[model samples]
Target: MFNKKHYKFNLNSTFAKLLGSYLIIISLILTTSSLVFFRKYEKLIVTQEYNLSEKLLNQANYYVDFNIQWATSFLYSLYLDEDIYDLMFSQSSHYKKNGISKLKHLNLSSSNIDSIFIYNKFDDKFYSSLGSPAENYYLPSMKNIIYKSKNTFTDAFIPSQIKINLKNNNITKNIISIAILTSKSSEKSLSSAVILNLNANTFSNYFKHNITNNSNLFVMDNNGT
Candidate 1:
């Protein structure tokens, strides 16, 4: 009297229908949630990275402006000194001695300039703040600035590759030489030049310590070498 086979068939059919519906509905909900989360997380990560990059660029710009200000200040100050005029017009052992002393003092006091020199074209000798008798040497580079500048002209930065012989010793340095063209009187004639050597590495070192260790900074001479 009991129809066991028919009863079993009905039970299996009911269970299969319920399981199919449950799988389909649950899969749809999970896939939708995963899609939405991925898009939001991706946008957040991209935004954060862009902001960080902009901040670093701003920091670099600030440092560059600060350096330029300091450079102009020091160079203009040297341009205004009257001792340079005396060095050119007067020639005395005592005068030369005092000149060297004054130069050495100025070099010591300056925070940004490394060395200063006033080259007397008439005497054909270079006098430096370092107190080392400037050597007579020939350089195969642009000579127009040395010969032609009539006003205060700072030469474009020239990266030092060839060692400059100072006191008979050679050294490689990155420097900018500010050429201060002088005249005995204002008559469109330049009598001599005062060269101010500014060390580029000094300014870079200031920010290098404060900036992140990963930040890369380089200072080169006018030649871009």
Candidate 2:
């Protein structure tokens, strides 16, 4: 038979061992709970970011459509102008100046429009607010685009470079462009293209809400360049 003192010592040792095991189990439970809570928080954050990104993409698409519609309307009105038709058919310098003057007046009336110009492919004349007359200002790529599309509105065509200068701040940059085709004649007798410059910053700022500490976002078209 074991001594009574020895028996008491064994009981005390066993109690200490049980207490240690309980402490370990409690620690494991706390750690598991903390991990689960963190995972849920991370998931919530991811969902919010995704929603924000989708909203931004929608906003961008909306602006693109809005600008295209505006351009279409502008071109439609221009096509209705008798002066433009007369200028195109006559190929006379006087009529051309008159048409350009009317366009300048229209540009001045609208706040959103920075400038407006007409390019006559038949006569190879360019009339614009810039006052730089060129015998041939038409880009072949643009010409091909206008030729292939017979619709009233065209898709967005962004340029590769955009440089912006802000006072007391660093320079910023972005890319945005659009083109619209005006049907001067239903019988394919006459047509003119309208090129529009959109505010890239305005378009890009829609995605600002989607930005997170470690996330990235971007947009691309079919060209994938």
Candidate 3:
């Protein structure tokens, strides 16, 4: 009978060093993959957020610009109407009365328009859309403004936060008032003005009511007031 042979395991430098290096390399690869994925995901999220913001801004601007163009064109047409010319120069109260009557029936009643006034420099008179003469007291405050913007359109009244009576109600509100010098080649050059008073609340509410959030949308004037 032969004795059984015994076997023993050995720990060598070459094998141990190679195993340690392999583990370190595998750990490094995993860390690099995680870092790359995190960076790309963060960039994607940022890009999406930027695109959304741009789209919203463009939409807001489109609505604002459209309203402005519509208002401007309407005012121009009112000033150029054939009957308004007679009202500007006529000394006869009857002609002025007839003109006022015609203006009331013009169907200029839009959601944004509160009232309209035609001021004649020659007669120093004003006709209202209400089929009456505007009070003389309100004339002095706005006379110089109409003259300064001769043959052009400008802000007739600046918008403010001050409380005032509107439609028989005392409240704080903003109003958009514009004045345009009417053509008067037959009498005096640019001797008349057509003023349009806009209901700013109606215009601004159009934007706010469409949104679910209680966000305020401000329509700023050229003066930023």
lDDT of 3 by residue, 48-137 (tens): 978865676577678767767877887788777767766766777866766787667653667676556787767777876754223333
Q: Cα RMSD (Å) per model?
A: 6.0, 7.0, 6.7
TM-score of each: 0.64, 0.62, 0.63
Better of 1 and 2 by TM-score: 1
Give per-residue lDDT, candidate 2, residue 51.
Answer: 91
Index of the highest-TM-score prediction: 1
On lDDT, who's better, 1 or 2?
1
TM-score of 3: 0.63
lDDT of 2 by residue, 1-225 (tens): 976663434645878889889999999999999999999999999999799868867876676567657766776676667876554455778767777777768766654554454556567544554354221232433345455655656545544343333455544334344555555334453356555444456545555644545556566655663
- How good is model 2 by TM-score? 0.62
The reply for model 3, stretches above 4 Å from the true place, is: 1-35, 105-108, 130-144, 155-163, 166-168, 183-190, 206-225
lDDT of each: 0.62, 0.57, 0.65
| Candidate 3 structure lDDT | 0.65
| Model number with the top lDDT | 3
lDDT digits (tens) for residues 1-225 of candidate 1: 986664444645878889888999999999999999999999999999788767765776677667666666766676566676556555655667767677889888766766777766566556777653332232322234465454556545433322567767877656555565664323343356666666767756766755666857664434564
Q: How close is candidate 1 to the true structure, as a TM-score?
A: 0.64
